[model samples]
Target: MMASFSGVLMGNSTAPRHWPAWTIYLRTMGLFCLLWYAMSWLTPNKILLPSPLDVASALRDRIDDGELVANATVSLTRLLVSVSIASLIAIPLGLAMGTSRLLEDLLEWPVELLRPIAGIAWIPLALFMFGIGNGLPIFIMIYTAFFPLLLGTAAGVRNVDRRLISAARTMGIPKGTLMRHVIFPAALPSIMTSARLAVAASWTAVVAAELVGAPSGLGYAIEYYRSMLDTPSVMAFIIVIGTLGFLCDAALRSLSAALMPWANAEEKR
Candidate 1:
């Protein structure tokens, strides 16, 4: 089965050529819509699971009124801020830990100990520390994004070919220069993978945080409408969140493909 799938992906003799990723995505979405419609038809209570058309209508109304855009903007802002901070802090520390055994020894235990804790688990402390505001959501997002990026970056750096590092050093290149030129490029694919994961984590954290403590975000909107038994509105907000997350990941993948041609080629293979 795996071989057949790979043959399909590679357009080999054993299987027909696979559809483009976007085409497959569209087909999957269409199937999901059909299933959703069928389920909505079968169910007696629209409140429990509203029809897709009803949800779409609710989404359209929100979009026309600018409420959806406003809430999405707030959520995206928090995601951006938290991810930016996490990247800044994690990248350099990850580099240091990867390069220096002493630094790794110093930080590894603490990082490992803390990494197991879920970002959602920090909600209470974040609320207490930052209060019920943007700060709380941002903190939660940062907490969610930080560890994946840190671990991914450090692993990437560590996995860089020893021969390449030795060759650079043997050529009398400065340590900083070697790191900037050799280590960074070699580790970029792993870092990019981590960044994508971090983005996903940031989205999840922001929504979870907003659901509990925020005043203006998609998660908050969903929670508010849910309380009122506004199932269509809740579904609309959820659809918005899922769409935004998908777009963000797609954007990251496109950026990675543009910036890291080698990585893209490897993936195609």
Candidate 2:
């Protein structure tokens, strides 16, 4: 089992080499579409689960009308802004906490206490604090994205080799320079993984926030169509969400590969 796991991680020949990753992904999605179609056919109520064709038609209409594109733009903007702000704050704070025992000791308990709380759980409080506007959704997205990034950065820093740090200090390298040259690179893989996770979390939180308060966005569109019993439209929006999430993750992976080529090579191996 361990050998198989290690082989998978190392991209070794544990399985048939003929099936590439993209081929497998395509096959899986094809199977999913087939299943969806079959389910839609078998169901008596089309309103509950719209057929793929119905969803496609609705999606095309929304695109032509600019509704989906406009709302998706709003949601994407909010997601990007929130995640950027959270990353800005969390990365430095996490690095500081990981490097400083005093700081970690002081903040550890409070962070632990808050980490378990779901971002959606704060919807009521956010609504009360920020009222009905972009602020509510942005706040939720930030709350969702923050901790994963913070924890990932801290873990990355803590995992850095003690010998490297000592050697840098011996060479008279300044603390900031040591962290930048040695620590940040060493911890980048974890940080990137956390960033991908943060994007997913932020997307989910933004949707939920829109459902509750926002007048515009993909979530609001979904809710609007759902209330009107427009299952096809709702399904279309859901497909949009999944596609956007996949795109966001892919973009992050590309950025990670570009910034940390060595890490990317190691991962491929």
Off by over 4 Å in 1: 1-23
lDDT of the structure predicted as candidate 2: 0.93
> TM-scores, in order shown?
0.91, 0.91
Candidate 1 — worst ten consecutive residues by lDDT sum? 9-18
In model 1, what lDDT does residue 267 have?
74
The global C-alpha lDDT for each of the candidates, from Candidate 1 onward, is: 0.93, 0.93
Candidate 2 similarity to native, TM-score:
0.91
> 1-269 in candidate 2: lDDT tens per residue?
99887887888865545788899999998999999999999999999888999999999999999999999999999999999999999999999988999999998999999999999999999889998889999999998999999999999999999999999999999998999999988888889999999999999999999998799999999999999999999999999999999999999989998999998688689
Q: Estimate the lDDT of model 1.
A: 0.93
Encode model 1's per-residue lDDT on 17-83: one tens digit a residue.
4789999999999999999999999999999999999999999999999999999999999998999
Alpha carbon lDDT at 18, candidate 1: 71
Q: Ten consecutive residues with minimal summed lDDT in candidate 2?
A: 8-17
